[model samples]
Target: MEKVLLFFTAASALTAVSSLPARSFYFVYEPKNWTEAQSYCREKYTDLATIESMEDVDILDNMKDLSQMVYPSDSYRAWFGLYDDVSSWRWSMSDSDFYQHDEKEFRNWRPGQPDNYQGNESCSAMYSDGSWTDVGCSYSTRSVCFDVKGPNSTFVLVNTYMNWTEAQSYCREHHTDLASVRNEAENQKVKELIPSTGINWIGLYRDTWKWSDGSSSSFRYWRGLEPNDNMEHCAAIYFQDSGRWEDWNCDKKNAFICQNGFSQKVVKLKLINTSSVDLNDPQVLENLLKQLKQKLKDQGVDGDIRLSWKKQSDGNIFMKNTEDIGSDRDVP
Candidate 1:
């Protein structure tokens, strides 16, 4: 894939642009099954709410007030964002770019792994420097978290014992959930975070887990014994339990959580600034960004494409070296 650089016009570059709206979810109380509810949500708000992390789940958990005020129905149960397709195995980190490279798909599973032990082992764990093994989603274990803050990556070793869902919640609440080791370097970084004793949870699971909006989010909050029978095809947040997910009959409609859509398309473009000012200057760059944004809006590109400066390894927004971002120049 080639990197793109956009040409900025000096004549009409400083035009005003519309602001991006804050995404929000709405709970529809109409009595409908999972499929019907999904369709309804698609027709009205965004698709069935896609819970990205524990924080997303938290928003769904607190939707009761909104539901009562808006819906005013006495229904207790509802579907939020999970369903099983009985397809092939998939990662919890469903980002395609994360695995675009050949080495990023590396999986060092233990021998005889992913046996789907008892037909419900959908979660995974890693201990010491050992390979991974599939485990029941309900099993309690320590967890590893990955944080992509600025240029420095931080991995947190959470020793607290909790089921896969709880551990994911903890990770999202504190750091990014079970590290998505893109390559060997990331895998080793997360591996070092885990102590030698107990098994720790990693961001890996299978179940054809999908979001309502047809988005691929590799995060699953399934209970230990899940996807047991393909008969119970739809997924729901077991509010009665610990907010872990459970497979239920699609026809059994419960109060479902709806969330705003944050679907984004990443576009790599090569752009050129027509202005004579320094593009590296902070204020100057900001104005250039605004002009680019407005120009994109004028061309109907709009808020979907956000214009921002990329940070360097040393956490600087603008690199001191005059090397192309896609070049093979090494920075230390």
Candidate 2:
């Protein structure tokens, strides 16, 4: 009863341990500007590192140890994923469903919209009749919610008046976040859901930081007096400054990090009762993926995994006109 397990051989012991697939960072020593570094990464590896959370930053910081040892003659300020977008309109919700086939870039704004009127109109809202406008985030208003990836493409219009931030919290808790109108069709649906009356908050906002690979991760890690919002500037991590992020001119050349492998895994599963819920809905597909991720973690797997649908060739999340089998694509 008192005996304890022991590792007889290092190789066998290493083989028995199961850890989540990690997004590893590779330090490239050659000097290149932001765009050139990105090209190099896409050609050889995956893409530029999209640091989503402190964990990602920590991983890069750990890699800094080896970077120091190997490239002592080089500068540690390397390029990551943050960049200055020519446009300021960004989605507040980071869900990938909005991204299927460049749908996220689709906009149904009224002419001269996102006017950033008064400089504080950072949040977006849609008129009950279907056009969108940017307004002050403090303005309280009703909001639309799309239960995408649910029983149906459920669009719920919450009548309670709340500011944009509060509306976001309410919608996220009840259904998904504030409605994300992907295209004209989806925008029409949202318009129909809300009365042809008051303004309703949607999931659009303005921000300068965007990912190189078109990811919408809103995570930011910056150093002292950083992100001065300089026009046309890009981001790089200063290794000497504790691996903190800094905004610099895009033309400045520096050695950078390349993340080559996908943090996602695609697994197909067959199921019954296909009519219970519309798995084709992005929100529903995302929720099911989350459940599967939790199930995996419950079985002693890593909890850092995120789940989403692996779109089919036709840019749909679920395979239609086929048996009820689906793919569980994990996001790191």
Best by TM-score: 2
Look at candidate 2 and tell me the lDDT of residue 233: 64
RMSD of each: 12.4, 13.8
Q: Predict model 2's lDDT versus the native.
A: 0.68
Q: Estimate TM-scores for all models.
A: 0.41, 0.46
lDDT of 2 by residue, 1-332 (tens): 12212212111111111233666788886778899998998787778888888888878887764344334433668887778664667665554543676786888888887665533566889996798998888999898876767424567888999998888777767876677777888888888788778799988877656787655567887897776644436899987777889877787777788885445434444433325566556566555555556655775543245454555688765453353122221111
Deviation from native of the Cα of residue 303 in model 1, angstroms: 10
lDDT (10s digit) by residue, model 1, range 129-191: 857887888998888877754434577888779988777667766774556666677777877
For residue 37, give model 2's deviation from the true position in Å: 0.5
Can you tell me which runs of candidate 1 are displaced by over 4 Å?
1-20, 65-75, 88-207, 214-219, 263-309, 313-332
Off by over 4 Å in 2: 1-26, 50-76, 83-106, 110-122, 127-131, 134-139, 142-160, 168-200, 203-220, 224-234, 247-252, 259-332
Count of backbone collisions in candidate 1: 14
lDDT of each: 0.63, 0.68
